[model samples]
Structures are given as C-alpha cells and as structure tokens.
Target: MSAVGLTYLTLILIAYGVSSCSSKEKTQRSLKIAGLSLWRLLPLLAAVFGLVGLFQVFLPPELIEKTLGESSGVASLLLGGGMGAVAIGPPAAAFPLAGTLLSAGAWPPAIAAFIVSWVSVGVVTLPFEAGVFGMRYALVRNGIAFGAALLIGLLMGLVL
Candidate 1:
C-alpha cells in the first residue's frame, strides 16, 4: 500500500481497537454487521473488478480517446451517457474507468456524465425496478436521469 493508505489503515485499526476495548459487545455486533455486509458485497466487487480488467484489456485507449475526446463535443456526451446507462455493476467500477478515460484524453464533461449516469441511471435494472416500483415509474425515472445527465454534461463542458 502507499504510505498514505498505510497511515490511514493504521489509524483505523487503532480506533477500532480502542472501540473494542471500550465496549466488547457493541464491537462484536459491529464486526458481525461489517462481516455480513462484506460477504454480501463480495460477489459484486469481484465481478466489477473482473469486468474492469477485461475492459482494460479489450478496449483500446486510442478508441476511447477518439470517441470521448474534448473535440468530440455533443457526441461524446451522448456516447458516455448512453454507455453509462447501459453498463451494469457499480459506481466503484465507473470511477476507475472514468479515470482511465480521462487519462486517455476524454473530456471532463463526458467523464462526469458517465460517472453520474452510471450511478443514477439503470437500464439494466429496469426489470427489477419495474417489478418493485411499476414499469411507468422505472421508465420515467430512467428517461429523466438520461436527459438530466446530458444537460449536466453540457453545462459542465461549458463551465469547466
């Protein structure tokens, strides 16, 4: 780990140790909850990182730069937003991928749109959302999310 990361880990460990000493039962309960949450999220975490590895290998940086570069303009926004909406997994995956895109010459607006839409929009989860919240609600929410993402991308491009 980096020095900063090691320092943070040390601090967290010290704090956790102190907390456990102060209240054993509470600490145990908290640990149990944390463990359960970790277990629940492990599969998703694995899948996302695995996908990221594949993405890094399969998608040429040249393609990303060409399609999502600053000069790509509105097309970049649309493509990024559309890709974000369709792509599944988590914000964890999006952030790293966005960084990669940015380093490869993608504009800030496109990257921002991608991250926002990836977190908020969910075309892949539509069926589940509809099953729980109704089809119309899901569709409307996704549509609004998409529209707002584009607008945010436009404004960001102008401001930044």
Candidate 2:
C-alpha cells in the first residue's frame, strides 16, 4: 500500500476503535450507513471509469496538447475551468480524468483549474442549489468558485 493509503487506514482504524469503545451500537450504525453509501456509489463509479477509459481511447494526446498545452496559457485555463463547471459527476470521478489529461500533455495549470472548478462550481446542480438557497446566493457562490478556479490555475502555472 502507498504511504497515504496506509496513513488513511491507520486513521480509520483508530477512529473505528474509539467509536466502538464509546458506543458499539453507534459504530455499527455508522458502518452500515457507510456501506450503504458505498453500495449506492458503486454504479456511478463504474460508469465514470468506463467513460474515462473511452475518453483515453478516443481522445488524441496531440489534440489535448494543442488545446490545453502550456502554450495555450490563460486560454487553456479558461477553457478547462468552463468545462469543469459544466461537468457532471462526483469529485472522485474528476480526479482520474484530470490525471489522464495531465499525462496526455495537458498543461498542469489547466488540470488544476479543471479540478478546482469541477469540485466547486456545479452548473448542473445550480437549479437545485438556487432552490435551496436564494438564486442570488447560488449565482454569487458559483461566480466566486469560477474566479477562484482561474486564480488557482494562474498561481499553479507560476509555481509549477
């Protein structure tokens, strides 16, 4: 296992131990909830991976480099951020796609923007968000996320 995986496992075990000691019933309930959530997520995970595989197979590396390469600069970041904002699926799914893009010669800053906006701004969920929170609030929040995504990409470009 990777160091990060081992660390996560150790932390999880420690938390489970403490929780079980404090209240076995509650620990069991928590575990059941987690299992159910994982079960529900399995189909989505499978679909996302399948799509990613297809993307890798069909999308040319040269095309990716041409559109999102380091030379594309600010335009690449903007394009990546826009695509991410409209992307559907969990943040977990985006990570693999971002990794694929990175390995295929997409600019690091573009990938960074993609990840940031994919996790933060959700155009697909905007209506629901607006319904729960006021439309104005949702718009403002998304706007902020979009701007922050671009800013983060810019900083990443400078640093990396």
- Point to the candidate with the largest TM-score: 2
- Estimate, for each residue in 1-160, the C-alpha lDDT of model 2 and write its tens digit: 7999999999998999999999999999999998998898899889888878987999999999989998888888999999999997778889888888899899998999999999899999999999999899999999999999999998998898
lDDT for model 1, please.
0.85
Return the lDDT, model 2, position 72. Answer: 88
lDDT of 2: 0.92
How do the residues 1-160 of candidate 1 rate in per-residue lDDT, one tens digit apiece?
Answer: 6999999989978988999999999888988998998888788878777766776788887788789987888899889999899988658667777877787778889888888888789988999999999999999999999989888988987898
What TM-score would every model get versus the actual structure?
0.77, 0.89
Query: Could you list the CA RMSD of all candidates, in the order they appear?
Result: 2.9, 1.7
Ten contiguous residues minimizing lDDT sum, candidate 2: 88-97
The clash count for each model shown is 0, 0
Following a full C-alpha superposition, what root-mean-square deviation does model 1 have from the true structure? 2.9
What TM-score would candidate 2 get against the native?
0.89
